[model samples]
Target chain A: MNLSELLDNRDGQVYRLLFYDCRPLLQHILANYNINDSQREYDCIMDFYLYLRGDEEPFAMLTAIKSEKALPSWLKTVFSRFMARRANHDGQTDYSDSAFDKIPDDEEDSRIFTISDLNTAITLIEQINTSYSAPERVIFFADIDALASNRHSTDEIISVLHCTEGNLRVMRHRLKKRVQQTLAKLTTND
Target chain B: MTDTLIYKYAYNQCTPDERRAVRDMLVSDFSECFAVVGLMKTRAVNDIESSMLKAPALALAVSPKERRKTLEKGRRGLPDVDACKNAPAPKALPDIAYDEEMAEMSEPIMIKEQAFGMSMYFDEMPLQPAPDFLGILNRYLQSE
Candidate 1:
């Protein structure tokens, strides 16, 4: 039988498929929002399952889905609407366009490091510091500072660090990429 | 997955429809959102670093440690760090080409095999028992 038929039959395998598939969605909601309670998280996932099992509209919507690939995004929309509605019922979410603006978009990218992303990067550096020797870590952090300080010329960095210009550029670039890779790993580690 | 649309979205260079598509995904696409944020952060830093690379170095006013602290401090957030530690594992983001034909198209899967623990991103808070639907479902299966 097709996935839709298996879903319609409420097959155990289908349940497993969806459970694993949507687990990340559940994780995302719990991670990003202020909801920290495990019970609440359980209820949220259970509610989504019930919504999908609903014989009226949700089940119909599930069957209507053409591509299995769209299932994740479609489920996300359902969750978004679910959260929005729940927030409205609880008198918490502001429906105005301004509210989304306040939802906090990419503050770290805006050069504001007083937030967690930067701290994660730092903690990540310490965690992976073993990969690099002691001198490498010190020099990398220092050179990034020098370049970022707006006071150091490339020549000055090379001279002060007692390294060739190419070495300075290559080492700094490699270290920066490592930091980015670590952050990416954190996000993609499922 | 590295899609031009996601790149455009990161840069705020996409059209309204494309932006809407990406915005919708951001709600559930935690990994994608993180990747996009990383991309933007890199771009922002590169812009500044590139400019600084060419400019001549002046008098050494700030010590390297102090200067590094300032830059790192600018990026670090204790709360966000805590949040990262408490965060669960993230799945791959779908590479959906957002356009007029997007609705009809099936996204190609591009899952990365990277070693990362779900609990590594969140804070020092003790992990609570995560809800598992399969456990309940398994009970029903046995009963059946």
Candidate 2:
């Protein structure tokens, strides 16, 4: 089914596949890792998707993902597995279901990242980041590292995140709202 | 998400009731969750770089001398009348005798006479009065 149709009938298997197969795990990974920064995580997620789609060079995707520095341990593990799988297949089966299936379902509960979930999150992140401002993008990036590094405090985050006090406040408020809107859109479809 | 709700939430401009509604939506909706995640990512990245990436210096470079030459050529190529017209008008009073002579003369003779008279007047006077005659002369010149 088309993307719109998939979104509209939220009960459909495809939507279920998208959610159960992707969203829930992605959310768990982000929350578990405390990846509070949306932008960098979003980029990492997009790079992961592009890597899955065979639309990006593996080395480039790896480099970009590495730069984010906030990738959850599970995500890194899944990525290594994905890389191994890709190598074994010689890039010929980049989009194959088998590749995604290799990620064990039980491992998901272990907070082990699934390639499928990362790919899906990457896709969603790419779609939303295109509409965000520069400052918003930075905060999102810093949030990933901050969460990963266990650093918390609006002032400290604002300093490391490189935004003014007022701007940080505004960005924090606006970003949270936009995230909610994007989530609604993703699920609503029509 | 509701636009009003999103706007309110974004600005922290929301009431407690609105904030609670936003929190509820964020918690219940997967789409909202992902969006929040994405937005947060964007904000994080924005911290380091916000300006559009610049093209390489070689691509943007234009030598100062080259720019100056271009500007000079542009100035030279402009119409003479436009250049002359834009000069601040001289603050001196009108040459009364010249004005009286022109007023007495017929239009056609005045035109011909003034053609030579302008050069003579300009040469003779250290400071020329704002050239009120120039406007009429320019119109006549254009018709020719």
The candidates' DockQ values read: 0.02, 0.04
Per-residue error for A7 in candidate 1, Å, reads 2.7
User: Candidate 1 residues A1-190, lDDT tens each?
Assistant: 3334534332222333333334444445433444544434444554455455554566566667776556666666777677666666663323244543454434343221211343343334333332432223434434333333233445644433334444444444444444545555554552
What TM-score would each prediction reach against the true structure? 0.26, 0.23
Question: Local error of candidate 1 at A174, Å?
Answer: 57
Q: After superposition, how far is residue A70 of candidate 2 from its true place, in Å?
A: 40
Residue-level lDDT of model 2, residues A1-190, one tens digit each, is 2222222221122222212123223333333333334443333343344353343343343334432122233344555565456446644212234543443333323321211233233334444434443344445544532443345546655554433454354445445445545544544453
Which parts of model 1 are misplaced by more than 4 Å?
A1-4, A11-14, A30-33, A90-190, B1-144
Worst 10-residue lDDT window for candidate 2 chain B reads B51-60
Number of the top lDDT candidate: 1
Off by over 4 Å in 2: A1-120, A153-157, A160-162, B1-144
The model with the greatest TM-score is: 1
Candidate 1, B42-140: lDDT as tens digits = 333222222111111211122345434434534222122223334443332221221221222324333332322213322222222112212221221
